[model samples]
Target chain A: MAATNLSERRLARFWSKYGFVLAVLVPILLWFSIFSFGPILYALYASLTNTHSLDPSRARFVGLDNYISLLDDRRFLASMSNVFRFVLVKGILNIVLSLGLALLLERLRRGRNFYLFFIFMPVVISQVAVAMLFLWLYDPRLGLINYLLSLVEIPPQSFIRSTAQAIYSVAIADVWKTYGYAAVIFLAGLLDIPQDYYEAAKVDGATRLQTLWRVTLPLLKNPLVLVMVLIVIDGVQHFTMVQVMTGGGPADSTLMPSILVYNYGLGANNYRMGYACAISFIMFVVIMAITVFQLRLFRSLYD
Target chain B: MTDISLDRRAGGSLPSGGAGADARIRLREQVIALVTHLLLVIFAFIAFGAMMWMVLASFKSASEIIAKPPTFLPEAPTLESYALILREQAFGRFFLNSIFVALPSVLLILFSSSIAGFVFAKFDFPAKEVIFTIILSTLMVPPAVTLLPLFRLVSRLGWADTYQALIIPVCVSAFGIFLLRQFMEGLPSELLDAGRIDGASNWWIYRHIVLPLSVSALSALAIFSFLANWDSYLWPLVIIYEEKMRTLPLGLAYLLGWSSRPRYDLFLTGAVITVVPVVVFYSFFQSRFVRGVTLTGLKY
Candidate 1:
């Protein structure tokens, strides 16, 4: 009987301790149930339907039709191509420029703080504001860039006007806005390096370039991976700048997948909700795959 | 700072100081460093120059803005564009709309995340590790994936164009909870134990012991949340159809009014107005921003 009483007391204490935690778990579970899981499930159902935003009552089930049609959509193909171009050109340029700036900032003797602040200023500004700023900068006639080009005897070219150049111009604007963030991250990594590595290299009669290549680059793996992963994730989700600056204009040359999804869901006259859901799902899978691969890559690199 | 100076001396610069040949090497190093400074300064100038040019253009006449050589500084600065933005457009309403959306969202995020963070940090429960890992893993999923479904859900709830549409969906941030949990995990357990010994409930301990201790982390998270909500454009653009309900960015976009003749000065003015508040807020919390970003890196 005494043992039985002791067991009851223990059970009571356990319940008392965890009751609040169980309460907290309810909200979390509900959140995932409603917001996270609910959305994906709804999207899945929508993807299998021929639902239109304008006429929700006439919805009918259609298996994979949206996905199959999306494959043939020229605009979707163009958006995919545009994303590739953006990821390659802007991604590579941003990394190189930011890394160079990081190295240069690391070498500075004075006024480093001021330079850091100034460089990162653009990043703190809203993307919408950045877009507007670039709109002015990309102005054909009165813009500073054009004025400078004229000074060097280069004729003013209309940026953000030509179908071929609009995406690249947008990419340039994005690179300008985000490169400072990458540079700062790289600088943090550079600061973490021990002086001993460089010292040993110098003792071995290594030149500055050799020391940098041998000591700095290898040690910077973690932050490099982190920055690269962040850039890729952000690059994949590029929407607002494209939406505001060009509106995916000049024959849809600047259209990214995100903007395409938004257009299909809301902007277009037809409002194909099912098609948009499929696109968003594909985007989700792509990002998840990239993220998983990156995590594995980072773990291996670190190990 | 001292370590850097010591490293500079120990890296053979002292020996170089003793010889004429070393003097030339030192001079060359200085030259290189100077050149680096010049390049950095040029980049800095470009950033500042762009901002200044926008502000100047906002005050210039439209003809002057588009004229040959492009007025570097407005020949005669005027508030005409500002007046036009305030009087003819719904700029004031947009500003208020942004504040209404951003402030409540920030407050809710802070309150909910802090409460959740405290529980995760201080409590011992079954499947804790798994739960935390799941939360962290959600960070990898890009927000774009949820947009369509979220839109559908919001529409279903009839929350379109309302603050509830904006605030409710974003109130529970995994990142904020994760950040606060990391911070709270570093706090001493004894303080909480003492609070418990005094017959304080979990909520009481959270209020008296945890909240005060985690002020820095909370403030940092607050700044980030505010900036994020303030800058949010696409989501608002999707939901808000009316001009008066639009945020600053959307308002600025529409101020140009889908017209062939874009009003350059008013657009610049609206852009400036949208950017300044954020700039001011960031400047005030600059150190916190650095500390926050750096801390996240370390935690990772």
Candidate 2:
């Protein structure tokens, strides 16, 4: 009887201490259940189905029709190419610009805060607003960019209207809006470098260029890798700017994978939900593979 | 540039009798400083100039905006566009919707994430490592992966056009919990022990000791949460169908899509209206914002 009482007391104490944590866990579990885990399961099921989002009751188990069809779709192929271009070109540009700005800002002794504040302003602004702003800025007739170009006797070029230039133009706008964030992260890494290293380099007659290449670049590897991975992920998942600015227009030149998913799943054609789900899954796998590979590569670099 | 050169020249003259070598070094240093400042200033001007242009264009008459050379400042600046946006477009309604949706979502994220963070930071429970790892692993998953599945779930629950659909699914943030947990773990354990010795309960310790000490982290999390929800586009775009239920970003997108021929002033005015609250909020919480990003970088 005494042993039973002791066990009961122990159980009561555990419940009393942990009851709140259990309560907290319930909502999180439900969130994962309904949103994260539930969707993933549903997406898997949908990927195997012939169901459209508009008419869910009509869904039929078609066994990989969507996946096989995706391989043959030309637009999907184009979007895939677009993603690669964006990931490589825009991603690299954003990193370089951000790192360059961070270095310049670090060298300054005065007005650092002012410059930091100005640079960071774009990051906090709504992407939709930035999109709209860039739309006006990219206006072929009255836009600032074209107007500036015309000052040096250059002819007006229809930036968003041209098939060749639309993707690059959209990428430029995105870089302007987002590279500030990369700069912020890089600045933090720059600050983390001990002043002693710079002093040591200077004492050894290292020039600014040499010190940057040997000391700063080597120490900045982790942040650079982090920013690169983030930019790639962000570039792949980008939607608002493409959606608002060009609507993947001028012969589908700027159609990103996310934009394709949105158009199929939610746009005017009504629910190609299953196809959308398949695309999302593919995107998920691609992003996961890239992230894992990059992380491993970075880990090896550190080692 | 001239001032820098002068300073360099004076320093060079005092340093050595070999004036030629010193002077050349000084000249090179001054030239580099001049070029660096010029480049930075030019970029700064471009950035600030673009923002200023947006503000000015929002006040210009439609024709003035499209005029040759595009008027630098509006000839007759008017509140007509602002008035039209607020009255005809009902941006006021959309603004209120954004506030109502974002504020509650931010509060929920902060409260729930803080509790979860406390557990992860202070406790040694069963499967702690596994649970923490699961939470961290979710960070690797792209948000797009959840879009279709979430839509299906929300539709099934008949929450497609409701605030619950907008707020509930996003209220529990893994990143928030992770950030706060990292911060909380850095706090000394002696304080919690002292509180226990004084017969204070865990809840009491959390309220009195932990919460106060974690104010900086909490504030940082708050700013991030607010900005994120305020600027959220895609999920809200997918979920909320009604005009009355739309957030700011979606509302702006709708306005852009509403007119066949886009009105520069009206669209820009809407953009400005959407941007102001966030800029104000950020400026007020600037220190926390910097601290948050910096801390995350250091840890990651």
Cα deviation at A177, candidate 1, in Å, is 1.0
Chain A TM-score, structure 1: 0.91
For model 1, state the Cα shift of residue A170 in Å: 0.5
- The estimated TM-scores of all candidates read 0.92, 0.93
Clash count, one per candidate: 0, 1
The runs of at least 3 residues in candidate 2 whose Cα sits more than 4 Å from the true structure, single-residue gaps closed, are A1-7, A300-303, B1-23, B298-300
TM-score of model 1 vs. true structure: 0.92
Candidate 1, residues B262-297, lDDT tens digits: the string is 667777889999988988877776666655555554
Candidate No. with top DockQ: 1
What tier of docking accuracy does candidate 2 attain?
acceptable
lDDT (10s digit) by residue, model 1, range A4-112: 8999999889878997787776797688667776776777788889898656788899999999999999998898888878877788989898899989887765566
Pick out the ten consecutive residues of candidate 2 chain A with the lowest summed lDDT. A106-115
Error of 1 at B11 (Å): 13
Kindly list the per-residue Cα lDDT of model 2 for residues A1-303, writing each as its tens digit.
999999999989988877666766767767767666677778788889977776688888988899899999888888888878877778878888889888877666566667767777787888899998988888898788899889998998888878888888888888888777788778777766777777788789999799999999889888888887787777777788888888888898888888888888877865788887788878878887887788888778765
Off by over 4 Å in 1: A1-15, A295-303, B1-21, B297-300
